[model samples]
Target: MTGPHPPRPGAGTPAGRPPVDGNAAAGLLGEVLAVEVTTAVAECRGCGAHAPLAQAVVEVDAAGALVRCRGCTRTLLTVLHVPGGVRLEVGCLAALTGAAPTGGAPGAGG
Candidate 1:
């Protein structure tokens, strides 16, 4: 018989803890962005390492999410949900690419 399952990778941590993968960040980003952000490419400013956004380390909470580079543990992106709009901080990415609109906007030509 299977024993109790092990704790999830980033779960069961102390308070103020964040998940350890970009999946959480992607979910939070989905609330604001219309594109599939996780599949995008991100170049870390600190180490100049390039990888998919999905590979970044992400810490998520009710207020916002923090994304960091896997290579050097440097902060890459931050997303905050605030009144009226979301605040995004992207100080860690030297380059990012591949984003498409989610579509279905009003007052747009078909």
Candidate 2:
């Protein structure tokens, strides 16, 4: 007779629940993005696909988050939580718009 196999690593989830949507990144992104970036439209340079940032697929690890285009799966943004602040690296993101600017104007109060 055979025995039951052990659970696979990273299969499904720890609680055996389905994966969460991109909206789950809202809280983490809010503190760094400083705006409702999730709702903003993001254009992918790779495949010319346009969609709200919230619709992008996000993968998080010990380092930080990696946002990819849902259509072409090309990396769009990489966010690294550093010592004092967050480090953002942009990739195949052609444009990001429709999100209201936060704080003051650029180079206004120095």
Candidate 3:
């Protein structure tokens, strides 16, 4: 018997374009977290789903980037590049867990 079919390229995309992965947010997330963020675990506020930030669905363009939960299509984060610096919107993330940049507790002087 055949298994369930997978989603099409544009299955849940509003613009009918395939969504990118969270790796697309590397630069933005790196600046915000001061560390590699792809390995960080992000908890989605909408569906309470947890996954590495690298696994989140992402959409990027000239304006900036948007990260969403793969399970519920709920936006989890947004990053905007402005003249001064990058602006990060993360109200949709309930929590995030990861190793500190220096491999120590966050805020602990190395």
Predicted candidate 3, C-alpha RMSD: 18.5
Best by TM-score: 3
Off by over 4 Å in 1: 1-34, 99-110
Candidate 2 Cα RMSD (Å): 17.5
Q: Backbone clash tally for model 1?
A: 0
| Candidate 2 lDDT by residue in tens digits, 1-110 | 77866656777665676557768656544544565687778999999999999999999998999999999999999999999988989999988875445643332112
What would the TM-scores of all predictions be? 0.58, 0.60, 0.64
Off by over 4 Å in 2: 1-33, 101-110
For model 1, give the 10-residue run with minimal summed lDDT: 101-110
In candidate 3, stretches whose alpha carbon ends up further than 4 angstroms from where it belongs are: 1-32, 106-110
Estimate, for each residue in 29-92, the C-alpha lDDT of model 1 and write its tens digit: 5534665678778899899999989999999999999999999999999999999999988878
